[model samples]
Target chain A: MYRMASIIKTESLVKDFDGLRAVDNLNLEVEERTIFGFLGPNGAGKTTTINILCTLLRPTSGRAFINGYDCVKDAHRVRSSIGIVFQDTTLDKDLTAYENLLFHAYLYGLKREESKKRIEELLQFMDLYDRKDEPVKRFSGGMKRRLEVARGLMHYPKVLFLDEPTLGLDPQSRAGLWEHIVRLPESHNVTVFMTTHYMDEAEVCNRMAIIDHGRIIAEGTPEELKRMVGGDVVYLRAKDNKMAKEILKERIIADIEERNGEIFVHGVKGDVCIPEIIRILGEQVLSVRLQRPTLNDVFLKLTGRQIREGSPEDEFKESIRSYRRRFDRT
Target chain B: MIELKVVYVIVMRELIKFFREKSKLVSTMARPLIWLFFVGMGMSRLVPQDITGTDYMRFLFPGIIGMTILFSAIFSSISIIWDKEFGFLKEILVAPVSRFSIVLGKALSGTLLSSLQAMLIMIVSPLIGIYPEMGQIAGSVLVIIVLSFCISALGIIIASFYESLESFSMIMNFIVMPMFFLSGAMYPLKKLPLVLKYAATLNPLTYGIDGLRHILIPHGMLDFPFYLDIFVLLSTSAVFLFLSTYVFERGK
Candidate 1:
């Protein structure tokens, strides 16, 4: 028997809201000092699981532990051992950034001198030291988010949980936030547990679990999960499609299918297969292109549905519309 | 010790927010004065002096102070609903602190703010033709703190059942108006009909206002004895504090 060190562990965790199972019999183990991503679409039990682990929601059954403390029985110990950046903004917009951080420091029981020092250090690290005196209401979305990240780290917990840290940020801000998040583990010596629906964002994780319908469908490194879709996809248009299919079938031992006047060669190395297809159908080939399997393909292969169902631009616009609607209500 | 710090910081946060909203302080201070000058001056002429055993304006003084504590103390706990609406409650809930600390912090802040407002009203007691000795003023202030603590805990209990400002305000209007009218803050509790008198006796604020009258208007018409007023206020504060803390802890 072997034991792998895990900072966060859940065994057969289940949570039910009314009759609906929000988190269905789940087991998860996350190694220390690594970025662990829980990849899922909206309502896939991401936030529900995080809430349970953070001691805000009790599990319906089974158990979860953080830093060896039971989430339900030893809730205070679990809370002291973990930090969470909620999916929505939790900052007090009326308070200055420094005051907000100071408030959190006090709640976490940090001494005044130590809290002040760490507040300054974290403000600088998050690049908000210059604006620390300004009320958070005056900040842009990105600045508010960075301040929240700083506030979460004020107590120096062993694990930091970010629930969709960049859900509504612009492309530029999203990239900027990721830059800070990517360096957190190395600089702060804390394990990062984050959830995101963005497939590209999942690539940054050392290990990730693809969850859907309250169950983890796949779990591994990004590369390992993508490898589940097999080799690169080859899409080609030939002058004589039927003749090219016959010739390609006779020449190569690969699965070939024709759809909409193009032949897709599956389970073949694109670089090696592309040259051979060109030689075999020299005159019949009109255009040839190789498409590498992405996390989206892995999701599609596993669940027969697109992970993100929309382009990034479309998602951004939808988020903007919803933000505007919320703004109008307020 | 750490739990005490948690309570301190929570109170500090509310105080900082309270100071930042200068309008809130101005409005709370102004509300009691409006009732004193407008309503008190308007209604004093219609009532006979013997009914209250003093001039109507003097008789209304303690009630005005009770009104200050009632309004400010109850409204102060609305911060919980505001925190929930703004998502700040989650931050407080996720912190490694006991729910009792949070509830105590909220109740104490409300007590402090309302007591300060009531004392401000007391300082202007002369404007309403009521004069009190230093000991009477100090005793009244003690009564104000206890009453405010009780009302604030009651507010928290109501707040835990609500999640939105609209719903909270709707329910507050339903509860707060009746509480103030029935609290003997605007009338003599003894003169009410038997059923109404029983209703007033059950109100914690009635005992509080009666305590204030016992001190500030020593010769004026009084409802319960001085000891009974303090006894009721203190015991109600303890019960409310326990209930609010239990509700908060169980909410999660």
Candidate 2:
């Protein structure tokens, strides 16, 4: 059983805008100093949850706490504890990178000398020391993202919330940011709570919650989630191998899926299931291969749908439904 | 201490952006100067002296200063929507600072920019025939800064609920222009209709204009009390500051 050692916690938290609930009765426990990734399709209430925790958006009902401070009643304390990087790049285009950092430091109440030292150190860390005096409008997408991260860290917050931090960056920039994210926890002991749609980004999280329709369907380490789909995944290809999946499901309790003329089976002991699967298919088995289970599989098992095809309205409806479920459960 | 820092950061950002757009400042000042040169002189002859206790060019000075502050504050705040479009609001909101600080910072920056524009217009006002003594000039400048702060607060409140720059600009046109006309900027409040007179009483700019008039020509023929005018202006600014801060703290 997972212990409830949460730096931030929500219980039946709901956010209603007019009649619609953007975030339905959300109950989340983010552990301290962990790289907790929030995986959700767009409009799945990931941003809303972060807003509530950051004390930006007030919850319609229920309670949320950041480091044990109520999001509403103790909003000031909550804000002091958490730093957030929004989905859209927020650097002032007209200001130099150094100026932007200085401004943010001031907003966070850092003194001049300390802020200057931190800005210098952060610029060096981000490899942006030479570009510090350049206006952010002239910066590349990756450079802007790096400055934003450094700015967020200037306050030395207890928790950092990143909303789709690398959404529009290039592949190399995305990978580079991942490297920084990997070291964030170890360097600062600051809890990292982030949301991203990128599959590769989700894989590196210390723990992640796969959210769909405003509800957390699965929560675990990347390996643990993949294992939820079963330990090893086998891809069986045949000209007419329809019986392969049925045989495998009967022989071993495992998940079976088909895509592009291939049958995918997930099982705890894959090698043992393969022979039985082969025997059942007989001469029909053209080829068989084994590989790892992915977060995509976990998404598929929980939602009965792919994350990409999900519409905003569907997410809104799911959010409302989850709110009702939470209401009833409570 | 935190609020002051936030305000300073906001003001610095606003100033940097304003200075970067040299074209905007040039065009904005050019439009007012054209009016000061052409229409102000023509209107000075057409309009009577009883309306403002001086020539129309002199009357135009205070109105132009107030108008500059009004337009600057309103136009600059439309960037709140731009901030939303650019996603900067998220970064600011997520910072470990109070929302009041965010509102204060934005308002102070916009107000300071508008007040600076007003100051430039004041320097030019004398060339157009409205002269103030050095002592009066400082007090009038102080009043203009306060007026800008109050107007900027109104802008912040407007930006809080509106989502798009187009919509905000449209609303500003509808509200700001009418408020300018309805106030005694162009004519004395007493010369207008009773309905307008009462309405003008509510316009913070009315008191601002009155206060400027009092400070500029302290021994003038105006019947309105300077203390009352200053008090009303201060109170209106307080109301706006309080409301803007409240709406801002809510974070939309």
Candidate 3:
């Protein structure tokens, strides 16, 4: 048993459901007292990875450690050192805020007096002390999310995991949650491992990984990943994609993708590339429009599609539907 | 020590939720009350005296108590489905408590609430001509408590495998209705088809109703063999509870 340190570390962690690999051989090292964001499109196995790290789900193979303890071999110790807030709200709808926090504290082995103090302090920190007696069923989306965070912190866990923390919140609620999440590290020095599909959330993180198809396709600071694109981006849309590509090629302009009636061109001299691209497209009987490429472009470059593809569950449901349709026809 | 505290917290959470759902309590009690008072009374006039060997209402009272335990236990099981749907169960599963404690907490809560419902139904039994000897009420409550635990364990065990609310309700309709009927809740199994009589004997609920009847009916017209019935019911509870906790551990 190593002394408690380095909040979370995983080496070649792999998770498979039936035949489909949900998390392929993945390695991650999350430092203590840092908010590390896991960014990916939907169905990129973010939730599965989070679940494994939290000890909610065991890995299919490979090793995971939390606070210097193996997730499987020392699961209880791993669980003791981490707290998780799932993508979905999980509070008992009938319990009061105070009761929820108190229950959570007790679950972590807090004494009665310690639980009372922690609940009071957390309620105050969340600005929910005034409404502590009201059941969670009455709280708004933001308050509920905040209470979830408070509940996660009730144990003073060495590491906190938030999976898609603001997927469905209004902008105001999202912003409010961001503030709370940002303040947590400064206030508690607890390591935070959060997963989000939102780019803005990723931008706020000190470091992150872009996951897709159950693999970490890229990992770095948001700045470093964006720098992978290496220049200003120009998106050229044309009526005739083949003609556009032909024209750009003829004019000696490189780094172009022609697909689905649009041309995505990336280069250092984006402004210079635009006019040349337009003039060539005009001669080739194709209408062209140009604009800058954002992170979406970086994502498109990394993966052939947009940031992520269709969710695995969606595909599973679709196959089920098709199977039902076949049976119905018979 | 902390596992017990965690279990207590979980039980309290489940009970608090139960009390808050006013409609749940009303709907749960409504069926047993209707079956016992209105349906059972009307049917009593039809259950010719020679066949049943006791007042028809009296025979139905123990069955009503069984029904109360069944529905309340199933109602508690619905929370398992609801929590899975709403993600609350996932949260609790991920908490520091052992998976064993999670199963124990839920079963105990269901047993506690269902027994309370049984007590409430007992309060009105005398007004309906199904009065038990005061001495037997305590034994009946004890039997019902164990039965409730058994039912709750079975409910949670069923919930562990199902993924959708619609499918769960479908299973409830198919399984619970037959368990209620074939176990002699509404009618005696001795008169049913031999196949059903054999099936009824397999139903844990048959043991519960027989055991309860042993204590709750007047002058012991129902020779239920009390200790044997209680032993069977307790064994059934033990089996269901073991299966439920095993499923819970694997399911998590």
Worst 10 residues of 1 chain A by lDDT: A321-330
List, residue by residue over A1-330, the lDDT tens digit for candidate 1: 123489899999997765566678889999999999998766677888898899987888989988888999999998998988988888999999999999999999999999999999999999999999999999998888889888888898989999999989999989888999999989998999999989889999999998876789999999889879998889999998988898899999999999999999998888899999988888788999988888888888997878777544355334433432232111
Q: Which candidate is the best by lDDT?
A: 1
Candidate 3 Cα misplacement greater than 4 A, ranges: A2-5, A231-297, A308-330, B51-53, B218-224
Model 2 lDDT, full chain set: 0.79
lDDT of 1 at B187: 81
Query: What value does the lDDT take at residue B50 in candidate 2?
Result: 57
Docking class of 3: acceptable
Q: Model 3, A72: alpha-carbon shift in Å?
A: 1.7
Error in Å for residue A116 of model 3: 2.0
lDDT by residue (tens digit), candidate 2, B145-231: 889888888888888777655686577678888888876777778778899898988888888888887887554435369888778
DockQ in order: 0.48, 0.46, 0.34
Error of 2 at A78 (Å): 1.7
Which consecutive 10 residues in model 2 chain A have the weakest lDDT in total?
Answer: A321-330
User: For candidate 3 chain B, which ten residues in a row score worst on lDDT?
Assistant: B216-225
Which is better, 1 or 2, measured by DockQ? 1
Off by over 4 Å in 1: A1-4, A234-265, A269-290, A310-330
lDDT by residue for model 3 (B89-182), tens: 7677767678778888889899999999998999997786665676788888888899999999998888887655776668768988889988
Better of 1 and 2 by lDDT: 1
